[model samples]
Target: MSSIHPLSMASPYIRIAHDFHTEENMRIGPTRIVDHALHYFKEGDGVYTVGNRPTTIKAGSLFLIRPGVPFSFSASPGTRFHMYNLHFDLIEQEDSAAITFPYPKQGEPQRVPLPCCLPDEQEMPVSGLPSSVPLVETATYEQLFFRILQRFGQPNTIALLQSKSAMLELLALLLRQTENQHASSTSDGTYETHLSHAVAFIQSRLHEPISLDDIAKAAQMSKSYLLKCFRNIYRLSPIKFVMKQRIERAKCELLYTSKPIKTIAGETGFDSIHSFYHTFQREVGTSPGAYRALAHSTALQQEEPE
Candidate 1:
């Protein structure tokens, strides 16, 4: 993990929020998630599942699941952890109707919502973990996440954008690392021009509304295939990637300009300010004004000690 590197140090989407782990406490606890769940886990071993089937989570791990997929597991005894529970409200949008707010010539296949999809019986099995944790050394994967979360104490466009970009990069790095771990072998390949083009297209239009289809088309791939590949590479859905970019750019106006929040929302490809506010709050953990004030005060304090 230490040798892992990224081509883009400046990704516009998918970023960290906050990351912290217990330094002293070495014990673990059990948790029950509601219908839908999104969370992060680090520095422990655990098994999670929708019900019966389980997947092992190790150090430097993050998990996000919808209603049907339930994660249930416990970490190794004496293992430390830094974790988060993330719940996304707009994840249920139907796939058939593409979100038409931004990004040109984009379309998505209809998605069927399985409200009652649960794990069937007969998949449960308890496994005794190793007496000690594995030699699972990891890099500073959570540093950007910690920074993003810490930014909630200060409000401003620069910090917000920085956090958003860092989050995107961190998520991509995570997917790459996880995939690499699961591979039986490795393939050495160069980058694709089309993938680069698609990324360029997204970055070029960061301030504009862009759709998943638009990105896929730019990459010369179908919606489903592009989404699969993109997630493999970026650890985020296309729409989500676009939204992260928009929100990142919006932070620019939020910090430097005096424009109304509604205007900022509109300019950033949001349907309305209320929608923007909700999304912003979800990502940053604070209201826009509150963030701005926090950032301003922090800047003042840094410049002139109180």
Candidate 2:
């Protein structure tokens, strides 16, 4: 009937680290959000508050505010400027800096600054970005922040994929933020590097018969560990991700080509036409022939509709 937030996903919407949001403020003073927020002001002046405490935001100011912490903002009377606001999640406060907030729990927003690792209810001004980030490019994060805010969420059939894509983009933005802000601490570095190897390893041989052992070897990880990593970081096992990718490719081929199902199966890497059919039905909830027909009908309906 309607759409739901993707964050409530059973295994965490993002497979890897906790997700976050980024926004470039055109003007946020007139409204409020009921989620945790990390505001990095790039330009102009605005007044913001958490509960009853007031915080002044301007270019080069950053603060982490948690959900239910009442906050409001107002642009300086004559300022023609905007600020980038980012809301992010992490594994732990120890994994980040003393200023980072790991609240929000995936779907809530704390718009007021909360003390990192502190049990206090009062607000405070903190300095420094997360360990994974650097300084000086904080402004660049403003642009990325806007992009994150733009894609937050709503409802759709593709809600899962859409939220995932948004998270991936947000990850890139955060990494860039770390770089730009010159974070005092360095990121693990290999989290993405090894992850890239894993994906490329899978992609390079998708058409052949392969096993978890082979894939893990290519990615330099143990099979068991890789499965956990894949599930945690991608919200899927390696095999599942491969299947999903193959199915997406198969959908394109089915709609755009006149090839036979057996041939398509071979091209997409199934051991037999039987396996292809089963996987397609399970993931897509429709057989290949049925899907093709439906896709064709939908296309024709669109072409002829008022």
Residue-level lDDT tens digits of model 2 in 1-306: 844322223121321221222233434432343333555655666666655656665555555454344456656665644445454432222323333443434565553443222112122112222311222224234433432443344234344344445444544544444332232222975555565577766655667876788778887877887887777655688888787767866776786679998898988889999999999999989999998898667545444424
Window of ten residues with lowest summed lDDT in model 2: 117-126
Query: How well does each candidate superpose onto the true structure, as a TM-score?
Result: 0.40, 0.42
**What TM-score would candidate 1 get against the native?**
0.40
Off by over 4 Å in 1: 1-191
Positional deviation of residue 2's Cα in model 1 after best superposition, in angstroms: 7.8
Residues 1-306, model 1: lDDT tens digits: 433222233233222233456543343223332233335675566555534545677654555543434335565556656675333222223331232211112254323443222121122111111111111112223444444555533446666566556555554554444443333122543224455566667766765778777888787877887776667755778788677767766665676568888888888788878899999999889988887787667556544423
Best by lDDT: 2
Total clashing residue pairs per candidate? 18, 27
Which regions of candidate 2 deviate over 4 angstroms? 1-186
Best by TM-score: 2
Judge candidate 2 at residue 20 and give its lDDT: 29
Lowest-sum lDDT 10-residue window in model 1: 124-133
